[model samples]
Every structure is written in structure tokens, then in C-alpha cells.
Target: MTKRSDFLAANKGLRVARAGFVLLVLPHAAPDAGDIRRFGITVTKKIGNAVVRNRMKRRFRALVREILPEHGLAGHDHVLIGREGGVERDFALLRKELLVALDRARAGKGDPPRGAKGGRGGGKPHHGRGKGPRPAPESPQT
Candidate 1:
């Protein structure tokens, strides 16, 4: 699932969020694609610097490899999205959470839709320069 489209498609699928990460399960849509189970990891810059993001990705990959083979659903694209505290979390705990997430996914259970929680978005968009053109500097008030 190296393509951006794959990730986007997966985002529209089932989502299970754990303390350490969010798991997205996209069932194979095309019969011709076969039962090829693919997976991807996304750790954004918001999580940390490059080093921290990479470390989280590494941990996610290891956990996926260890657990996916036995517990993962075939013909699905599994995407793990890293959260803020994921880096500092214990590996054992993360692994346990992943297992629980997978089990929930297996049972066709997913957390609420991302937008269900709502956002702090009623205010207008803000830019660093502030309030659109600053009233054209007021021209000394004549």
C-alpha cells in the first residue's frame, strides 16, 4: 500500500483506535487482486522529529509483522496511524493494544467515525499575519 490512493481508500474503511495507534482495515475490493494482505504505517510530523517518527514506524512495522500473520484478516489493507503518546508507550502494551484492536476488527467492530467527535472549527480560519489585511493600515484617519 505504497500509493496515496491506497491510504485514502483505507481511511474510508473500518477504523479502530487504540491508545498507541489507530488501525484501519480496508477489505479487498477487487476479486482480481487476490488475497494479498498489504499493510502500511503512517507517523506524521506532529508526532515528533524525523528520528522519533522513524522510531515509531519501526516499532509499528515490527508489531505488524509479528501479529498480522496469525491474527490479521486476509485480503485486507491494514494501516496503522501513530498517535502522540505512541512513542513513549511500552512495546508490550502497544502489542497488547494491537491485538485487541485486531480482535475488534475481526468482529467487524470499529470505533466511531473520525468526524463524530466534532472539531473546534466554528471560528474563522487564522493566519499568522492576522485578520485578513489589517484594515489597510487606517490611512492616519484623515
Candidate 2:
């Protein structure tokens, strides 16, 4: 089992690699370091009741165990936070999401760069220019 100290140390050491579904916080550790990377799972009360939360945590742990050896940074600490939907989400989808997040993290110098956006129909700027028409005033309700 992973140790708490390792997670603490990792949090202290490196920047975080994050995605919408998961956040990976990695610290710098040597490839040959004897230290076993640690993992921590956190699911907030907003997710669900104790049972549901526990289930989410378990799923996250399993996913981490399965993917860590292949994608984990040798000397980093990692934490996975489960959203409310995470508990009900399919395992395969979760795995795919995690892997995509990890890949971006790895490729971009251990943390995905900020402002890198992607989504359905492509990412468009959220704000309209000042030239856009203003909204009309609402009429009085009957």
C-alpha cells in the first residue's frame, strides 16, 4: 500500500497536472529512486453519501493502480478527486479520461499547460466583443 508521507512529500515537491475529470499532482523524483510513489484519493461530500463516496474512491484507487506503473512519474505524489458523476461513470470511460489527462500531463513537461482548451464543437471564446448588441429590457409581468 502507498504511504501518506509519500503523498505529503509529493504535494510539497511538484506542480499539478490536471484535467476536468481528474487532477494529477506530481513531484520531482529520480527515475532510480527507491521511493515508492504514493497516491491519495479524495471525494468531497458534494459527491454523495458515505457509501457512494467510498465506491468512487475505490474505483479511483483501482484506476490509479492499473495506470500508475505505466504512466506515473517515478518520483511524484498523486491525488485523485472524484466528482459526483464519477461514482456512476463507466469504468472504461473513466480510464480513457484519466489516460488522456495523463498523456497531456506527460507531454507538456509534467503538467498540461494552462489555457489549453478542448470540447465539443471546438472551443470558442466565451466573451463577445463590445460591439455586440445589448439585450432588450424586459416588459412588466402581468
TM-score, each model? 0.80, 0.60
Task: Give candidate 1 misplaced runs (Cα > 4 Å).
Answer: 118-142
What's the lDDT of the predicted structure labeled candidate 2? 0.67
- Report the C-alpha lDDT of model 1 over 35-65, residue by residue, as the tens digit: 5778999999999999999999999999999
| Strongest candidate by TM-score | 1
Residue 83's lDDT within candidate 2 is 66
Candidates in order have lDDT scores of: 0.91, 0.67
* Candidate 2 segments whose C-alpha is farther than 4 A from its true place: 1-20, 28-35, 109-142
lDDT of 2 at 121: 40
lDDT of 1: 0.91
Candidate 2 TM-score to native:
0.60
Q: What is the lDDT of residue 33 in candidate 1?
A: 56
Q: What digit string (tens of lDDT, one per residue) describes model 2 on residues 1-142?
A: 2676655554443344433245656654656655556677878898888998888888888899999888875565667767667877789988888787766556654443344454544465556556677689999999
